[model samples]
Target: MEKSTHEPTADEKYEVSSSLEKGTNADNGDTRFIKSPEERKLVKKINWVFMPLVIMILFVQFIDKSTLTVSALFGIYEDTGITHDEFGWLGSLFYIGYLAIQLPNQYLLQRVPISKYLGVILMIWGVTLGCHALGRNFAELAGLRFLLGFWEGCTYPAIFLLISTLYRRSEQVIWFGTMFATNAAAICIGSIIAYGIGHMDGHLNIRAWKWAMIIFGIVTFFLGFPFYLFLADKPKSRWFRLTPEEEKIVDERTRDNAVVQNREIKRDHILEALKEPRLYCFFFCSLFLNLQNGAISTFASQIINRMGFSSLTSVILNIPYGASIVLFVAIATVLSHRFQEIGIIAIISCILPLLGAILLLVLPLGPVQLLGLYLSTTSPAYTLLQTYISSNVGGYTKKIFYTSANIVAFCLGNFVGPIMMVGHTAPRYTPAMIGFIVADFLTALMFLYVRWSQNKENNRRKHLEEKGLISPPPPNRELLDLTDKEDLSYRYRL
Candidate 1:
């Protein structure tokens, strides 16, 4: 049989109608839709499927990555013949491998099935984490750490992409916050696990720290199969069963997100993204914010140890640090959702850390200094930054590029963070604290600039609409897959 040459009809080419949908208001002609009871139920179902999987995957990744710090307390350094300075290199090298592969990973994400890609990487890294148990020196452990970082590099971007593809822009902040908050929770869980494992000293002739790596690694390895089976790449994936109406709702939601679902890379989209000033702004903000994270996450236990606490006591002290992180993340996300103003909420988040930095710099090593350290868990602000990028950026390729650039900056900050705390600095790493304070202040300023730029664009569009210079956008404009700069009708949320 000869192949038929069939062209798509206009209706088929654009599945959405030009008229506003049922939930949206036609009078104001806004694209925003209030969810109906049916839509709410559908969202709930999606949450049930996605939330636990993401939380578990991310939690394990955090726990596995954090094992280095816990192990440091449990005598991985002494047992493995590694010095404190060499240990910093281990932390920094992970990000080096993480940074190196991101551009290629972005391309792979564009071409591959996301769930399968993530699944394979998860399993590889799981084995890599377990290998840490066998390393007896710096070179051996550092090599495994690099491989672990390289494999784990794609995990966060994949999760961010999944959340963006699944949820509306307005709903993304809460979900992002929820997933990232796992990092804080992981600190406590890791500490408790380490404390338990510490009691296993001399069992089976293996060290407690080594056993920590082995146990978490095995658990992570087994998780990969189930994750691959359960995660849906998009709403249309075989993992989900949707009625016709529900499928239509998913399509409508995609349109409302103002991002392309198409996988094809567009050169114009990349060029446009390169020209965007906001892209660079977000990049620097990510870099500076994570510098603090690099320092704190790797050295929190050691700092407590320096304050005259025993190894076990130091591990327990991190519980308060973890609690503070959960509190800050919860508050920031809720306030951002309530006010619909991430910029301001991000500023508040930064301010707390800035105060924490000041306290750390001035106060002596005691309960007060510890209080400052706990207050410095501004990592939640990083979650807000991720939400900002996913919700504001448009076009598939541009979004990918934006996220890749942000990750590069994130890796750079993490790579440099540990290096700032020299061994001689010890408990009073005054210079590092100073760097934290400065970075936090600059991040706040960057958020302000983003908010200002968005307001300027919104006002210009409003004026043009009033003067009849530009017509309101068609309801199907989002289906066109235009970049944010190309889509004049798209107003950025603060």
Candidate 2:
């Protein structure tokens, strides 16, 4: 394929300058930093500082979310005196608000500058979580958790925007996968915090579980500012202590990556995004994948409790689950980079969870069986699916929509997962496993549909070109090869 030296038309260049002057509150300077090909390649490589910031924020976010699960060992469940089913509701309610905020959050990322917007969100969630220390009933706790979800929803889409803007399609899966391993770290760290605090139930005449929430909230609040100061709003807006060359490299590399197909966000383009079929199919797949994700987030602690271990040991033993997830993510990232076959990687990941659920349902209750459940449930499907979304959806508007839709699926799954842990199924958790099995099969089917549809589109393009109905396909780095652009018959991952 001919290399794209596709500079914007004069009108487009003028529009970008006009936007910079009006939006950034600065006189127009040399704002648009283009680069030579060598500089562009160097910059396109990852920025070390930003990658760590992304990992840190993601780690903190996951720890805060998963810490509640670890709290089960400290008598939080008993203090609340909620039924098994109600416990599920308490767990799932966060996502109800989480889903509600997805679209608004994505919109804000596009409109409000990221530094102010994302930093404010982090502080809001941190303070709201601290309010949990005062919760006296299920209703009060639920409200705080919901608000936390609402404020925290901004982070996911924003992170997606940052990474999608920084890294190219091939580099994303590794960083995304590594960032995802924070889920495992969160689980391990949450358990460690809970284990230490679980002993303080009578020390301060307060419940250990309440202490768990209080401690984590304070830490998250403190970490927010440093993270905010360090995060790059976008490659073009980066203002850290980097040398001029580093800045130039980042700007050039990020632009060449298919990610920045359009810099100007418009209302008409936003509406046009809603029409892509890939957006919808990916939504369903994400929903099912996240259902399992949400279920595990809510109940993995309880599942471990059945393994004849103390809450502390249950928490500690569960470290392997997260560790396994880290391993799976790393493996998947390598495969995606080497083979570029998102479909096969996704299929294998989904199957692991399906097998894990089956083992939980049929095998005798024992350590081995329980280990299987943990291994299967914690597979890397969720992050890999997200990689597929980021890699394929190139249009800025469509990326926003897809990102929001994925979070919505996450919310739905989180909402449904806990509810399935019926009161009758407590300890046995038979019903929850059954729900997981069904969700896994549906997720697999969606991936299959995504693969088949993309292949069909590719064939159609080939046929049309053979008949001289359309231009011949270029060598693989064309927009068609990148597969992220709209209007290219690039099928969305179901």
Candidate 3:
């Protein structure tokens, strides 16, 4: 298939209509959607300006949320004299706040413009992060953590909406992969930042961890001020960059704002979203995948410390996971784009960590065990799986529903993940590892099932066409039109 460098043109109604059953198919072997050289140059410019700004915003959000996990290793538990069990409460408390306001967050993302709403949300979370310096006890820490969660919940749903609006289905996979990979960078950078500043424990008579938290928080808070100036709410809204030709193509490809418009959530919209089987499959599968991911993210520093590595060494060791994530995300994104087969890559990603989980559960604490833990952290398969879903699912209401459900499941999974680390399972952490292994296996099975169900649905639709019960023509040639219609060429591929 030839890739189009520009969107449909005004006089070229053929480009827009060709994907429908009633029109000629542009994607037939004899025809291709290749753009003119001038059009390709314009697309390159727009993508360059926008992709980095979006990725940077996501990176800061992850760094702020994840720093606490690393801080637990050298700062809080070391200085405040808290036990590991008490530390678990601190780690898991954020999720309580996360789940409390997911639906509200989605509403804000949908109703308010991204320029104002998301900018406000980012500033609030940054302030919450800075306030960690005020928490002197468990109760204070828990309260602050909840507030942080409340603000942080806005990031993912807002990003989903931005992505659904900004990019075509084929282009969103890499951007989402980059977004998730930033968390791995947080895992690495947070530890290094913590290790460097941790020695400031008695500086000005404040705890080192508290200072680390306050500094990063203040930095993130101030960073939001700039995003307000640079980030475009949608492709049509780009004020500083983009040629008129580039804007026209993007507008047409995205249906000229009709498909990407900000919408108000309604009761029936929620009900309509709840009826899809793919929604449940995505929720349950992602729930398990992130359960394991949360475990790795929240407790990795502690696990490294317990393996007899010094604080500096522990931080240094974390670099591998972050490095691996960068490589894997790039590889996965390219493979998904080239093959147009996200499901196969997703399945392979799930299996890697499952093996790693088993190794962590059964092996003795040593270099081999540490390697297992590091390898376990490299799964971006679920990241790709989710990108596929987010980029493909049509209609604003259903997209929001699936996005919110995914976040809710993520919070729920993280909540349960820490609880599994009961007092008896501490230190060695045999049960927590075993639990992750089970979650991985189940997630893998569900992904396979969804893939099978999608194939079956496609086959059934084809059979109906033969019997004249369904339309004879396929709309795959006109992918843009597929975004709005509920029938004919529209079908969720899970």
Candidate 4:
């Protein structure tokens, strides 16, 4: 909200931009003046070309994550001779692998071509998933699970940070929403696909679970090719075939988005991120929001079966559960983006899970309680939180560090959740629900504070500017590669 004394010069623009990507080359397209109409067409082309492939990659990723959850009902437990306790540990192991990779990923994402890296990883990831079929014991399966998590961990943040480079802050809301919505579709459709695969259990003498893993793995392996071949690596990538004018538009966008593409690690940015309250808030919000998600995803079939539904019936019921999440994500993202009341929307979304948690505690183990279980897993808060950090965080190093921390928080919540659902509790995880209630409440308060803190800063900056104590920020101040803390003219998006 504060202003800078100077508008950005060409040198400063390059300083900030050098971090995001190499600018358009002369031979590729005419990198000159662009009209508004041409810019719209380019963006629309990007939406069509980019978003669907992203959805496919993400869809496969989500389905792969839930493979363990679905395999449980298809004879994996008995086939592997694993007990319930070991099953829970497998969940944690995956996240442990995920958490381990975050720091390394921060560096790799900047240095490597993210699309190609992710592609090869998915191809490898699919092979890892299929290998689950060969596990005859807990140790083998555990190792496989860890590897799966390790590869999968490289995805979400990479996609998110890439989006920051591709679109303006305003354009990102819908894309982020679309990306989160993929999980719901994956769950709904994957469950149906799993049910169909269950019938294949005896055909090849390969149990239904093994077939499920192998089949999905093959599909995932092939999906990587498109990414390697077609996904744009930078604003000026030849893949997009932007006219020179459109490339110019992207340059303008680069300044506005303020995301640096440079690979250099800045110590000051890291220190600034460590000192900021938003970093912790992003971490804790994701951690708490995902706690219930981890538990439910791991145990959905068992919980529904205990409610007296058959395993097939339990899988079928997930259709509705997944469908509901799509709605929740849609409503939350649309409303928050439309009204610019993201914090309030986030606070409200958190309340759904809290109420759902309360219902799980008070209601008996049956259909009603099952409804509570579904309610307890609201999906919108996570999306909003992710968007907030992606839109607001500046500086390549700081954003990488910040995004890695958020992923780490996500891993921690998920890692602890399954273990917390102790076998002694059996059907109803009363204690876990109580813990979830607390986490959800804290999530709400954190969002509220983030909004208030940012708004207060906005007001402080506004007052100073009005008094002429500070000049207006340079039109392209973001091009300086400044962290949010270092940028005096920066305003936090609500």
lDDT (CA) for every model shown?
0.83, 0.68, 0.69, 0.82
For 1-494, candidate 3 gives per-residue lDDT tens digits of 98879965654743443242343222111112355554466556656766676777777877777777767755676666667677777767788788888988777777777777766777888889988877777778879988888888777777877776776665677778878777777667766777777777779988777887888888877777767776777666755366555655665456422245546554555676687676787888777876777777777776777788887687778888777777777787788766655667777777778888888877887666776777675348667766756755666666777788988988887777766666667556787888788888777777777777766665665567568886633523333322323544444333
Between candidates 2 and 4, the one scoring higher on TM-score is 4
lDDT for each residue of candidate 1 in 1-494, tens digit (9 for 90 to 100):
99889986645533433234454222222356567565677788888877788898899998988888878888788898998888888888889989878988988888888878888888988999998999999999999989988988988888888888889888999999998788889988878888899888779999988999899999999889978778878866665677666677777778767775677889998898888888888999899988888888888888888777898889989888887898889999999887677788888788888898898888977766787888877677888998889888888888888888989999999988888887888777889889989999999999989878887887787678779987666777757888777877766878
Candidate number of the best lDDT: 1
RMSD of 3: 5.3
> Taking the tens digit of each residue's C-alpha lDDT, what string does model 4 give over 1-494?
97778988655654443343333212111122223565678888887777778899899998988888878889998998998878988988899988878888888998999888988988999999999989999999999999999999999889888888888776677778888889988989999999898788888689998998899999999998988888876776777788656666677777667786887888898888888898899899999988888888888777777788888888888888888788889998899767655678889999888988798778887877777867766578888888888778878788888888999999999999898889988767779988999999999999989988887776676667568877665766655788766665556777
Give the clashing pairs for model 1: none
For candidate 4, the lDDT comes to 0.82
The root-mean-square deviation over C-alpha atoms between each candidate and the true structure, in angstroms, is 6.1, 8.8, 5.3, 7.7
Model 1 scores a C-alpha lDDT of: 0.83
TM-score of each: 0.93, 0.83, 0.87, 0.91
Clashes of each: 0, 4, 1, 11
List where candidate 3 sits over 4 angstroms from the true fold.
1-39, 78-81, 240-244, 255-259, 266-269, 462-485, 491-494
Clashing pairs in 2: 1-475, 43-249, 44-253, 291-413
- The true-versus-predicted C-alpha distance at residue 293 of model 3, in Å, is 1.5
